[model samples]
Target: ALPDAIEEVSQADQDAFNQDGLGYLADKARTLDALPSDAWEPDLAAFDALIASLAIEGMPETGLMQGSWLWVGQRALGSDAPTPVLDPPAYEIAFGEGDVQVRADCKRADGTYAADGGMTGALSLTLNPTTMQICSEDSQADAFLTALSQVDRFAIAPGAHTMQLFLPDGSVMSFAQAE
Candidate 1:
């Protein structure tokens, strides 16, 4: 039997992602409204309440995905923990308009992608079947290809420096923007 399609967030998972990874938010360095004179203070109590209300309403967000990325390794689907790649630079993916270029170990493949995240950031991608050409004995080409095939959705980090392709079974393949 398969596990539940929608797993409720455990307390552990919820706590892990909350208030963490606030690097960008921390750097925001913004105060709602400030008065030039030290003696003057803007009464933002009502404004604070309004801002909290709007946040509860939720805003749709989108991130740019077209670019080159070097495979960084894998992580749990919804987690930010990093797992180092054996030889990070060997694998990479370059996404263009409706198409993707993949470099898996010693093999290369061209394919297509569809991202209709609309407001939710959903994505779909497909790649040509892996080639049969022999790779180095230690190469993980086949495994990488399999992971790519299972990617159903993705998320890009705040700085657009990292991307994670999440598989249905909870394996997330991570990639970093290529220089």
Candidate 2:
């Protein structure tokens, strides 16, 4: 005859059964059931390509304007009609050894600029546009392009990460390095 009460199962045996048997099976079942037949799936190839492109886009180039910069605001001399650029357009400037390039959301200006006089407080820049493309009707772009043409002096903040370009009208254009 069978015993009325069976011996108590050892704690080690119970733990092993829970981890290696039931737990393993439960995990496997969950993994298989996690995705439904109608569930949407991402295209890994495209995802990987997008990630690669973003990485490349974030990389800083080699030169003075090697890193990416964004427009913060502008301070004019007398009036502030262009009030603090609350939602400033997506504008950027990249400087190289002897070139300055600008990219606004709807426009682009690429030309040669000289910064040699910057050291002696004779800072000056000239944007002789070789190419100008207008993609959209952007007033901020217009303002920036106009300001770029008028900028004659520039100052790099003590940190060297922030920059200010002074226009002939005493207006100042501010920029900060991108993360």
Candidate 3:
């Protein structure tokens, strides 16, 4: 039956069917009324090799942190209060070779903040913002600056599109890659 089925299939159709097709056939063979012992033993060496070739050796080290990230929101600080984000005043952070910079646009004015540190390891960040130009209302800009100063570590999501900075005061600032 298998030989007759193979003979009926065209060469192009056979070529189009890859290992996944073989896997499907093998699975179907298991549920059939009768089949040869070798029917379900499709060679999986190619699939294993493909998987092995795509495996990453270790956690991503530096590529994800080298871009501008826009502030989405902050983690809820307490049980009663929810995290609030002021969308009009965009807050952003940019990572350079070994330095970092920050920008926040408050309704009244905008500020530029800079620091002189970067990722110390795969999951660690150390930023000591040396200069801050406080041109906006002190409350929002001051809170954002304080949070930036306290960020000692960071975590990037698997796809590297989203990130979170962990602050010493148990707050997490969430960010997404700037478009």
- Top candidate on TM-score is 1
If scored against the real structure, what TM-score would every candidate get? 0.60, 0.53, 0.48
Q: Which should have the higher lDDT, number 1 or number 2?
A: 1
Q: In candidate 2, how many clashes are counted? A: 0
Ranking by lDDT: 1, 2, 3
Off by over 4 Å in 1: 1-65, 76-82, 118-120
* Model 3, global lDDT: 0.55
User: Cα RMSD to native, each candidate?
Assistant: 14.2, 24.2, 17.0
Q: Rank the candidates by TM-score, best first.
A: 1, 2, 3
Per-residue lDDT tens digits for candidate 1, residues 1-179, read: 22354366556544554644332222221221233333234435655455446542333323434468888888754457757778767888877667888888888898988874422244677898656678888887777778888786677886778887777666778888888
Off by over 4 Å in 2: 1-66, 79-82, 86-89, 117-120, 128-138
lDDT of each: 0.66, 0.61, 0.55
- What's the true lDDT of residue 114 in model 3? 34
TM match of model 3 to true structure: 0.48
lDDT of 2 by residue, 1-179 (tens): 22354356557655655655534433444565465534425554565466556545544333245465677788766544435654444788877766777776667777776663322222445666524656465347778778878876666666567777777556778877766
